[model samples]
Target: MGEENKIILHGTWASLFSKRVELALKVKGIPYEYVEEDLSNKSPLLLKYNPIHKKVPVLVHNGKPVSESLVILEYIDETWKIGSLILPEDPHERAGVRFWANFIDQHVLLSVAKIWKSTGEEQEKAQEEVLEKMRILEEGMKSTNLEICANDLGLLQILLLTTFGSFKAYEEVLGVKVLVQENTPLLYSCVTSLNELPVVKEICPPHDKLVALLNIYRQNAFKSTTN
Candidate 1:
């Protein structure tokens, strides 16, 4: 690919969405530039490029900007057909994979955010809601015997890593063991499977890194509260 058609990704290193996009690009063996953005002080280029969400994981193709991590993933897959595939080829399998990805994004990721950010009785309520959602997710996983992609990592595994990885910071913020083999058997199993895969094992962030970032995030949140 020429520089004129060069791909550039704007994202933060710690963002799950950003990480997913990065992994997709790396799997496709696409050469791209990475721009780390600070959400608090977002770049004018980022704002102009992704005026809709103004979010990270913005993939700039040539001069065209494509926002949304999932969309970028599809684009990367289509643009470069190298290495293992991210999505399944069969139509039914693709739908099933997307279903799981959407489910985790809507339920687990959203619920985790609420559970970690709230306080007092509100926090308790959020935690209860998260547990209910997790139960539902676990039940759903129990019924599925999905096949892995050529990459050895599928949508379900990606979603699982995203959801369970969020809880890696629980000890730092909630001061509790939120996600473990004992606490969340299904999720823990999925995470463990993903970890065994070379691609996922190398790509996923370490729990300690997330914990440190969460501590910083929590400290900043408290300062904002007291201010």
Candidate 2:
């Protein structure tokens, strides 16, 4: 690869979206420079690359930039054909994967955010929303006929395992169990299997680190809302 062809990933370790891109890159065994950004002080290159959203997990390939974790994942899979494919070959199956990935991001993750960011009746309502969304996801995934163990690491698997893999963080931070085995059995089983993969095993930060990160994140969210 030429100097200009070098690949770089600008991201923050605290950002789940950044972790998603990192997971895809590691799973593919792709070599790239990882530039960790302080969300409070984003770099000039990141802003130049992603002027619109100006967020981390911005992929810089051959001097060109690609923003958004999902788009970056697809780009990586298409650009590099090595390792396990992130999306299925079958068109229908591929569509299902994409749909569920989006659902997890838009629906499931939003409800989870509500849990940490609110309290009292609102937080309780958010907890209910989390279970309801997960229930719908569990049933919808049944039609895909996927086994409880995720042998193949597709887009949906990447999103779920990386996001919900921090299941304990939700429980610890909220003081109430939200993503438990009894509530989301299929997800629990699949995340366990996914964690066994060599490319991505035990990827979550330590418990103390996780708790500290959650506290910092919650504080930032509160600041943003109050501002």
Candidate 3:
């Protein structure tokens, strides 16, 4: 492929959204250059590529920018059709995946953010919400029979992988266990199984490193609040 035709991912290492794009590219066996961005001082390329959000996980394919993690995943799946399909071929199944993926994005992610960024009564409420959401997700996974299959890792699994990876960081900072075996056996199994995938294992940041980062982030958040 020509240089211009090559894929270039602009993302931050600490960002779970960025990791989603990285996982998709690796799973598809797409060769790409990664440009790590410092969110404190984002690169010009990221600004130029994603002027609207100005966020990490901007995928520049053939010099065309695709922003947002879920959008980037779908773009990769459609662009590189030879790899594992991110969505099922059946329309009903695809819709179901999209629905649950949106649920995670909207509900679960917001709850996690609240838990990490709040304290006292607010944090307590967020913690309860997180557990409730996980319970719902656990039941949903059981109903759908979602597992980490080698040949069919759908978009929902990818989203869950990112969510679960971030959950470790939040769990450490918040002093909570969201994915215990007894509470969420199926979802816990899925997380463990996905973490072992070569593509996922290669891209996921170390657990300790992520926890450290979350600690710093929580401290900064607290300082800002008190000040």
Candidate 4:
């Protein structure tokens, strides 16, 4: 393929999965057009390309579509070998990184999503699960303190940033309140550590915005049940 046949990404700005792909491309110095998507009414192109998951962070290289954020990251790393590499060169190290990445998606992302979407007792239960999961992440970070891999960010740091970003949304959209020192101190510490990093500080979302968003969701959820 020629220079004009470069990759194109379809995703949403608020989506962590989409953010992952964007960060991977930015780290690799890969230039590609970005198409913001509305998952509520997905674009025909998105449905056509990623018919399986039909999710964002779909990468099209030379018109070939690759869905799933992690899969797309691997594609970007393999296709463009310049700048920072996503996976480690060592096979064992690479496996470790992959393991955490998957863990973030399954354990953190999954639980946090429920925190935002559920309400009443359901929401409370989900919050309990989130606190437990955050504890697990906090322990992992304390134990390994994984070395910075690419772009001065470690595997745990990336997971923390992405997972916290999602939690910020939950705290913003749902009335289920969370205080750093009160509810989940370890998770709060995790967020503080990740925020201290220069690169992460630039990429992550603001706390105020998350809180404001959560207020709106809470009001809406209240109205839905009451009225």
lDDT of 3 by residue, 133-206 (tens): 98897788668766543435678778878878556666777787656677777677777787777777798888
TM-score of each: 0.83, 0.92, 0.92, 0.75
Residue pairs with clashing backbones, model 3: none
| Candidate 3 lowest-lDDT run of ten | 144-153
Candidate 4 at 56: error in angstroms?
0.7
Q: Which of the two candidates, 2 or 3, achieves a greater lDDT against the reference?
A: 2
Indicate the residue-level lDDT of 99 in model 2: 87
Candidate that scores best on TM-score: 2
Best prediction by lDDT: 2
Instruction: Write candidate 4's Cα lDDT for 1-227 as tens digits.
Output: 37567788998866677877776676566778889898889999999999988889899988899998778878777777787667778887788778777777888678866765677899899888877776665566456654532235434445555656455455555666543446567656656665565555555666676567557656766667667
lDDT of 2 by residue, 1-227 (tens): 56866999999876789889988888888888989898688788888999999888899999889999999999999999999899888888888888888898899988888877777898889899999899889888887874435676778888887887777776787776677688778887888777767766535556678888888777777677678
- The candidate with the higher lDDT, 1 or 3, is 3
- Model 2 has an lDDT value of 0.82
lDDT per prediction? 0.73, 0.82, 0.81, 0.69
lDDT ranking of the models: 2, 3, 1, 4
Model 3 CA deviation exceeding 4 Å by range: 144-151, 224-227
